[model samples]
Target: MSTKTPTEDDILRPIKNTTSKWFVLFGIAGLAFGLFLIGWAYQLMYGLEVTGLSDWGSGGGVTWGLYIGAFIWWVGIAHGGIILSAAVRLLGMERYMPVARMAELLTIGGLSAAGFYIIVHMGRPDRMVTSVLGHYHITVHNSPLVWDVTVITAYFVLTATYLGLTLRYDISRMREDLPSHFSPVYSALTYGYTEEEDEVIERMVWWVAAAIIIMAPLLLHGGVIPWLFALLPTYPAWFGGIQGPVFLSIALTSAISGVIIISAAFTRAYNWDHIITEDVFRGLLLWLGFFCLMFVWFQLQRIITGSFFAGISGTYATQAMLSSVIYVGALAAVMAVLIFIFAQALRPSLFTKTRALVAAVFVLGATLFEKTFFVVEGFQTVEFSIYEGVPGPYFPSLIEMSSVLGTIGMVTIIFLLVSKVVPVVELHAVEHLQEGHEPEQEAPQEVEA
Candidate 1:
């Protein structure tokens, strides 16, 4: 018997269905993004003085504030999103195949948001770009910022290419059934496609996934990002070898939380519960718990190491960690509860999707707060001799806060628009499910002569 294939209509339902709710969400996101543009224009006109960032010596404030913190957070989300998708592919975790496309989209959206933060952070983005382009060699080797730019750009290209290549298979398979408006895009995606090309593209994507898995944990978040903080000897709280692992753990935690949030939203809005499934949520929740455990472990290590010393920097670092006790405690408590709930989920009747979703939201908020506190508090407590009696008042300005909201809005808009263009759920995965459900045909009996 032949197995039934998933129809293009099924995959394109999200695009075809134009509900009032979609309009409401899109309108809100567009409005917020417009506000973000306005905020940037205001900054351009008034200069960096409108924000709280300042030169430590001249103004007695932190140069990197909410923007840098947000940068780190968005970068982590991007790295984590790709890692999740790669893990599902590389590890043969077919159960997660349904969510892989969503994760990849998250990576793209997250990176876009992160890049926007970098532009916003640079008070004079044009000058920064001109200088970098003009004197490329001067800073490429010596500057960690240049290294970050290099890695982020490379990763973005690699990811986008991976997504584009993979879409060829889906687009070609669904060519006849796709909407007329999508024909141009489908043609571009499936140009020069053949049955033989699928294998080649699959192999290429596998290698790309492999590259991302290695580069993300080792080079991006684990190496360059942490080094930005750890290499600075002046910032005692950030100066440590363990910073890499800590950041990695936090990245995974936040990424998983983000996935959970998106998945929950899609399930609720589109009634995609049948496709997304409960197992996916449970699996993601368990992984989220594991990373949260790692986060707590790393925090303990930092606290112990810092509090062990009597030096001013060490003492101040300890104080900073202690000062954010509520966030840490909340994170730890949520992790523990999730661990228990995940265990209970394995056996029987106690598993509720809402509980896991609630836990994920809590973890996301707690992690963001903890990270922002880490950045701001590190600067708040100064140990340098020259800046001894200076008052360091660093709070996010109205513009900075608006920019944050705007970036979030931008991410939402990106996801919404992209979903209209492509199937958020992988078509192959849907086909696989159909195959599993196909009825088996028995062999025919021999005819009597």
Candidate 2:
């Protein structure tokens, strides 16, 4: 077994030469992000008044449904990255080593996207500062939002610190001859630093990994999604107890897929030799397959539960999911995810570059749509006394759409910019291979290279 490590020169190559496709991608991302900013500014100046939201129905133009749905999706992606980082570090799995840094980057990026959406979703964005800085005693009855915001912030800080420290260490390894600061302040931030060696970094990685593995899931499943869905009495048929678990599964799946797709795109655009091999993709597919199994079972539970008690609205929301138009979209999306996974698992070789990219995009879209059903569809059915017999229809206006696009555009821009400056794959993986676990080789000899 040989890990063909990329040299410092190879790592530095992308940074030095940004004149080609890199610039183009960044330019597009930037322009889209600028558009988002302008749109958001327009919304802010005119208020939700410029949009379709009415004072009549306790409405802002933006639907909390879409924002919350996307928030969960992004949170899932973030958790997936955290899990990837943690798994690699904990197990010392050399195969996952290449993607550790990549995974961490996704975590930060996805979380940032979710956080921004939270702000835009709010009718009162100005209170965000007060929400963060103001103090209150923690109690079960108190605002879960307070606690959620706190935990999420802490998780972000920890992950960012871990990546920053590791990146600095990677820099030192790639250019040991160069002068760099290791003052007391910097070392403290690096969490009690030592020599910038592969093994040392791995051990440091172990600590960060353990922390992420523990914290991210807690913040996401235990904290965020559950906090939203738990309050509702009228959970749709599709949303069984399995929603949280399934949410976790899809989150990890999408997060990993996003990382893989982004990394592959980076390789193609930059022609970086450090791009992940087929074995990595195969591993990703395997993980995707596992998620597929869970998702399939989750769907089956919904359908069976719904079928068993047809027309039963109060107790079982499953019936609603099976028969509803919204669930039609949700079910189709779920089926697409399953078919994609089955295609990946049954005859793995068929997933070529183009197919894998297609599959990845499909799965992400399906998962996002599924989330839409989970959030928006159920909210419409809640038998609140105030609503009487009339049902709510969540039709997001252009203002909301613009906000959503802006957030996504911002996230894409951030990712593109980061890919240019940061090493997308972990340098430590290469170093570990060079340390005699696997003999080094050139491209012509590698499988799935």
Candidate 3:
């Protein structure tokens, strides 16, 4: 049986086909983003008090709250998504090429959300800019927060450049089919484009991927973000050698889950099931399951180390973990589902796309809950020098919750708008589909070795 090859027209369907459903979706996202801006304005006028965050030594309240938790979550997603995209390209994982551009888009959206949260969390956005710019030379070397800003900014630039370079290739190919309104943007993006430039652009992208692979694990997610928490010895839960790996694992799991959700949505909306095939879903699921398993292992390591005849801080960390029955149960349930899905994969008749998608949803939810719990609970176990009292339970205020919703809305809006402008699916992926390449049957022995 011959598979249908996707033509340039098919690749450019999103640009050519402007449907009511797209308008409705874009409208909803725009509305949510508008509401978010309003909520942010309200926050600015009111102050940080509008949210659940409280300063240390002030009525025995925790400093960081939902915003910081969300900051970490978004940053992790950005880091992991870009890492996956880079890794797939670097490792020659053609099986995932269909979803590579989508993953790259996730990196952009996630980083944008993360940057927005940093501003929102400050409550004084102007001050944040002034302070960073004024003290960059003085604090860049000494401050973890500054270091985080540096790496995140660098990562964002790298990912964006990688995406832009790749887009130039795609846009040049589809320049004729693209809408008239996009002519200016296309010309700007593809300025001085020629057929000979393709190889040069490919080499540039490969080097960028190589740099990202090095920086992501060594400097960004695995270094600065985790160090923000781990370096603080006062918070026993956050401070440890394992914090980096644990955080990286969560990032990967959440990022993979995010890609699965996005791919499924695109498949449903665009009816590109043939291009975004079951093989793509299966590869992502396998990676997600592996990360979820690693997450459980890291949690066990954390629990055992903290609970074995531990001190006040260690005991506090262990107790915090034990007390969160909901978190533990959610993690366990997701793990079990992933395991079952893997089992079903062995027997093709038992496997279903919906099952994998559902598991991805579960992992996404579980990771969010777990990260929030980590942030809140780390603050709860406060090591005070003078004042001594139980810290109050930190419940996010209406404003804080609104901001969360708003940020998510903002991400959706950005993605929807970007999709309208550019092909969500990569041009090379369409060509790959046209070539009718079969999925690899087995791993190479050298790769296995």
Candidate 4:
């Protein structure tokens, strides 16, 4: 056996191994997906009538609050993967190489959930046929909602394609071991080639990079989020022109952190220590650090600008974000303290396992904070009337909560399914490292006397 330590790339390529673990993960996701289907079917059978929503009160449909909120939140979380993959490809950032494939997979998995959430949110889901076929009853010029649909759909396709091609690239390298039955699926996924697929893969990769550069910023416009904010007559915090973009930044920050958590969890679950190398952890930590800073900046900006807008309507919006326990202000404070502590404890070195674990926890907390705020704050921004000239709290009812949880389950299921089929990391990109490519590792090992 060779005694030399392998390069990061060398270990990332999947070995021809299978265990019952994939089934277990898939089973959990499937259960969640099934729950979502139950909720979905219930909504379909009863229509929006089963929900606590009323046009007379607040348009209290499940559509605007939890379903749409989660839709935008998940979409925000997804942008990190898109940005990371596209940025690395464009800038030739080799450090990002280890995680690029997984990042792309994250984009596909997250966005697929976002799409499903949108469909589930439709009050008249049956009318989705008409909407997709190009009928529109609502429109606002330069609406984030419209742009969101366009860009998100594009991303779903582009990221899925990119991931599929990359998976194909990995499978092609393992052609010797791949069974005959799986060959066609592998070839089709890879765009139908064996040897010279690099050129095709490289070109597609750059195209996605370009798309990411353009669409990432556009994707941030709070998309469906601003639409949700617009539902409120009095709430200005979520309605401001800057709110959408600000939320976008928060989304990217959270999504990246979530990816780090997911990566760590999967590695631990599979005991694939070699594949998820220190380099990958290091790269993620660096980004998580930057994310911490950006999140703080965004929160401060919202607070400062929001404070100045302290008239009745503006003040309400500001208070909604700043005072709501579950929403904006508290989470921001927690993130600030946690991130500072994490940054101090974390070193730039990827080899430090204890520090890496701490960093992962920070990223997860910060991202979850950002997402919780997106939903809870958005809910507060909309004003509601209680019985007979009284104002009411914006709590989600039972059905709404169920629906939201169901969509989450759906997202988990889709990603779980994909993981079973595709190599989540790029195999070929790392395989070259094992072929006597790295200088230091090329030397023969001496036997003990």
Q: Which of candidates 1 and 3 is the stronger one according to lDDT? A: 3
- For residues 322-372, write the lDDT of model 4, one tens digit per residue: 666655544555465446546554634334645556555555455554555
TM-score of each: 0.92, 0.84, 0.93, 0.81
lDDT leader? 3
Clashing pairs in 1: none
Residue range 129-188, candidate 2, lDDT tens digits? 666445445332466566556656777887887787677676545544322443343345
lDDT of each: 0.80, 0.65, 0.82, 0.61
Model 4 regions more than 4 Å off: 1-16, 55-63, 134-147, 191-194, 219-234, 328-391, 402-408, 432-449
Of 1 and 4, the candidate ahead on TM-score is: 1
Question: TM-score of predicted model 1?
Answer: 0.92
The residue pairs that clash in candidate 2, if any, are 1-438, 2-438, 2-439, 237-317, 237-318
Error of 2 at 346 (Å): 3.5
Q: What's the distance in Å from true for residue 200, model 4?
A: 4.5
Residue 391 in model 3: shift from native, Å? 1.7
RMSD of each: 3.3, 5.7, 5.5, 5.1
Give the alpha carbon lDDT tens digit for every residue of 105-154 in model 1: 88998899988887777787885587566777998888766777787888
Candidate of highest TM-score: 3
Error of 3 at 78 (Å): 0.8
Which parts of model 1 have CA positions greater than 4 angstroms off?
1-8, 55-58, 325-348, 440-449
* Winner on TM-score (3 vs 4): 3
